[model samples]
Target chain A: MAALSPPYLLFLGDSDNPLSIKIARGLAHWRPELCIGETGGELSLGLKKMTPAQGARAGAKTFIVGLANGGGYFEPSWVGPIIAAIEAGMDIASGMHQKLSDHKEIRQAAQKHNVSLHDIRHTAAAPPLGTGVPRSGKRLLTVGTDCSVGKMYTALAIEKAMKQERLDVDFRATGQTGIFIAGGGIPVDAVIADFIAGAVEQLSPPADPGHWDVIEGQGSLFNPAFAGVSLGLLHGAQADILVMCHEAGRTQVKDMPGFPVPTLKDCIDTNLHLARLTNPAVKLGAIALNCRVLGAERADKHCAALSEQFAVPCFDPLLHGAGALAESLAGKEE
Target chain B: MAALSPPYLLFLGDSDNPLSIKIARGLAHWRPELCIGETGGELSLGLKKMTPAQGARAGAKTFIVGLANGGGYFEPSWVGPIIAAIEAGMDIASGMHQKLSDHKEIRQAAQKHNVSLHDIRHTAAAPPLGTGVPRSGKRLLTVGTDCSVGKMYTALAIEKAMKQERLDVDFRATGQTGIFIAGGGIPVDAVIADFIAGAVEQLSPPADPGHWDVIEGQGSLFNPAFAGVSLGLLHGAQADILVMCHEAGRTQVKDMPGFPVPTLKDCIDTNLHLARLTNPAVKLGAIALNCRVLGAERADKHCAALSEQFAVPCFDPLLHGAGALAESLAGKEE
Candidate 1:
């Protein structure tokens, strides 16, 4: 066999997209020649390059269709076609040459797939994030939706946990919080964008050379329509992992019989299992248990169970015992 | 000063008519040498034997008073008695005996001073607390009140912070919660008691010979009244140092400008000040900042300030960032 070609997978996650990066990094370790591809024009180029490489070797493509990190506005699942087209045999991967055939394929696939993915995000997929929207121009932004527990809390908990371990990190400085407030509560999309601005500004940030700088998207990725759009941006930006959030429990421990508190042992086996069961080999970086339903004890038990059960790390957004989820990935543990 | 005599002060919080052990331990701390005399017939004998020992020493008598931490169920203004007793050269302490008094002079003086002090208990102001029960068989089980941020998100934040630093603490073990239902949730009194039970259990676990324990109380002397019993037990336990919890902001720093993002350097001064403010001669143990209010920025700022301002060690409960709130105190790092 000739020199093995690099395996590229497209990943898209909403705001607070910690899980995506986790999966990306984890996969990087699983195989030596794997590069996570961002969803956008560059991805088109990468996919085009994959063929010649595949002509020389073999190329494989994968992407998370619909991810729900926060709200439902971001669940269009049509990103599959672009990735599939590029994978199948597209010569336009040289750059952003939108062939009429690609548009027809995206439109027809969007209709068949329910959510119109490509038609939505006409704006730059990696929109000068981290930099505030151009001081004067009012441009349409792709923001994540907010439900009960969303991006801010997740970001805060993840960062705080890292700081606990004596790692150096700055959320606004490098990790922008682009919270989209159109849907009421502080929007994580807008917050992330804002953080991106700060990151680009540098502000003499103490970033590590080893860790991958993670940009997370918050809100629902599973909504039938927005999933494709969500995947598009994630793939384009070259995100490393995704942090999925789901509602859980109620008041305290709903049941105790034989359920001696959820522990880290069950985290990955349960959460990661659920995510993958929905779509296997999608490259789930890590698992995050949103256990607001269960009391602290039960949540702890769940996280413990996940950690023990699966090789992948499992975390509870509420308990937040695992410090610095993103910081570790970003590598700048100052 | 023949051998310096017996440097002890027997403290009777309220009355001795009906003895309560909580009050007894309290009195013991105030007057270490006073042979705790029973108000029953045994008192005559007990006091007689104690008198010889007392005579051997100087004129140190049992300091009788009550309601040092907080007021009685009816009138909670007992701080006045404590302030007065301490001012009158009677070492003030925790614990309150029954209110019923036989001495008119004592009653009138106490009433005039609005002091809830008494030397007699309802039953027998004797050694055995149950010696003078009112036939209900229920000895006035002197329950100390506890009322820190009872049942609130803030409390949860405090708990979260403590655990992050690996503190051997159980935030919800007290059966306390901030969630509310019908009649304005569980009574604050019950919440306080439950919380105290958990705190005590965690703080004074099976004492190991190798570990020195650090027990956390409600607030401070200046901000007392978390519960009636803590002071007495603390006194009986001979708590040599007190770690006060003070909010970290403003007062600690002069003309501190707001930062684009919070930092650790801003808030450490306050944490240090509170810890070092322990009685001049008595050693000041570590201080734990309830960093729930202060986010990453504020918490970081305060922690730095605390380290620089006072050589005194400080902790952020939210950060659990320092050592731990519970385990560190219990000396159970291992």
Candidate 2:
């Protein structure tokens, strides 16, 4: 993480959509601000609403809207709440593919209000390709069975725990949400096909031998549509340690019905094998289970059983914290 | 290889430099156009020279200068020969780090002559990072023990042999000389560091499983300064089979002190170990020796001895040809 962003007003324009609902919930659980609220539809999360004046009073200087699947389209209907937030003197930060600055009325209002617009989806300057040169440091990448299966969440949790232990660690964000939290990172998916690994390399450059770079992983190798990007990142990251992430209740790959959810061991083996291509010493260090779907008791039992099976620490990052994984990493040889 | 350029008058400005001499000799050995002629110094190779008007008559539309270490600075003496060529109604194509098009005098003269200035150093659009997704086709990459050790030469020769055998093959050029002959390729070394591998990936995209892409490799892993680019290309190429290219009688790594030249077996093992990080199935297929230093008799004996030791067919691509290597590849199963 580089820069710390200002406190933000969470704006879930339409909470009925899956991407919007998921993001709103995730933000509340992770980075809860006193100024949290959703516009349009139902209030899906347990955060109280803040009036524009109240939000501003609470040091909320920016409005953040995290809506995936909404690529660069500013719907005509959601103008009121956004403009109201802008007029309240809050800058806007959006993770949607569409740029809010591109909206005619929104642009005019923001200009009048003198509020800055930060489109998280606006990709950074193209990154040079990874040299695949060996560097001094340990890089741990979180790989999953499918997309959005807690890879970023697990890495963030591990980073937080590592920091608590006073270990020199850094989080290398890859996707939009991770980038927003980290304050700086490339939107690897949006980059041209050739430079994916190069972009990852830029995000996580060589560091000191004692340092650990916790890289946020993207799509899974099992994902038919995005496996190339996954392989690119795997090689580009040049990771020495790997963490397998999986959603507890997933039975099949997201969007691909014919593909069964890969076993944790299989995923670990595949990842280790791929990672070894660039870093022959790469090894799977831990297993992270996203068990929000399963109750805490069930999640604990599942993790314990898997930990015993795989001979490694396994836990739900959010529920049980990342202590075991962080401890295992701290013991790793530089 | 994409677009075919008009025939050009090859210019070896001050052919004393190794790069200048190598390129001049290579062009003569391969693409021999009656229009081609060396200028600005002594003629080094055994190629017939043509007058500017005679070159034009022979369909030479441009003056091609392949100078390494020249960057973009045209020497004071070079101006005379270059301008003379331009005045003779010839466009200019240079593979120098500096842009001739940016040179005031060169630009003005080209403008006055109504000739286009092609600066090969002007990098193409930054390539996107690789997704590491699996494309359908089989790709073979030629890796080497050092720079300019016959990686490109071997790939080109193998491609030629494969095509003659009626196999579906494509030659993917990664450097300047290859790009010049191929007409359409990104000058990977000129590209920003991050996009090197991505650029290679773009040069060789996925195709049908039977389609084979012969990718030209770059720098050696043993070379400390350029290992990153080498590793990037190895992974980005997503090669299924790897061909090791080495020069005969080399005792040490080029320009790197205290580092002894690695054995062919060791080079193959190191390359396979790195390549397996991306494609687990990647295997070392053959060895191509650059035996120009050793004439025909010694070249064949050295290759035969190395072949007996490595258990892989080894040959000087220019002399004995790449028939064995191509045949071995043709027999490979997907």
Q: Is the docking of candidate 1 incorrect, acceptable, medium or high quality?
A: incorrect
lDDT of each: 0.32, 0.74
**iRMS (Å) per candidate:** 25.4, 8.1
Across B1-334, the per-residue lDDT of candidate 2 in tens digits comes to 2243567687777656655556556666666753365554665565557656666666778777766653456766676777777888888777766677767888899999898777665654767654455668989999998877989899989988888777899888777777676665776655544455567778888798799999888877655445546766776787998989999989877765545677777778878865764678998778899998998999989999989988889999989889998887777642
lDDT of 1 by residue, B105-158 (tens): 445555664534322212111111101001110000011111232212223333
Worst 10 residues of 1 chain A by lDDT: A175-184
Candidate 1 local distance difference test against the native: 0.32
Scored against the native two-chain complex, candidate 1 gets a DockQ of 0.01
Residue-level lDDT of model 1, residues A6-104, one tens digit each, is 344434333344542332333333232444344422223122333222432343432322122333232344344353544443221111113223456
Residue A240, model 1: Cα distance from true site in angstroms:
2.8
Q: After superposition, how far is residue B193 of candidate 1 from its true place, in Å?
A: 52
Which regions of candidate 1 deviate over 4 angstroms? A1-149, A172-208, A211-214, A249-285, A324-334, B1-334
Instruction: Evaluate residue A45 in candidate 2 and report its C-alpha lDDT on the 0 to 100 scale.
Output: 64
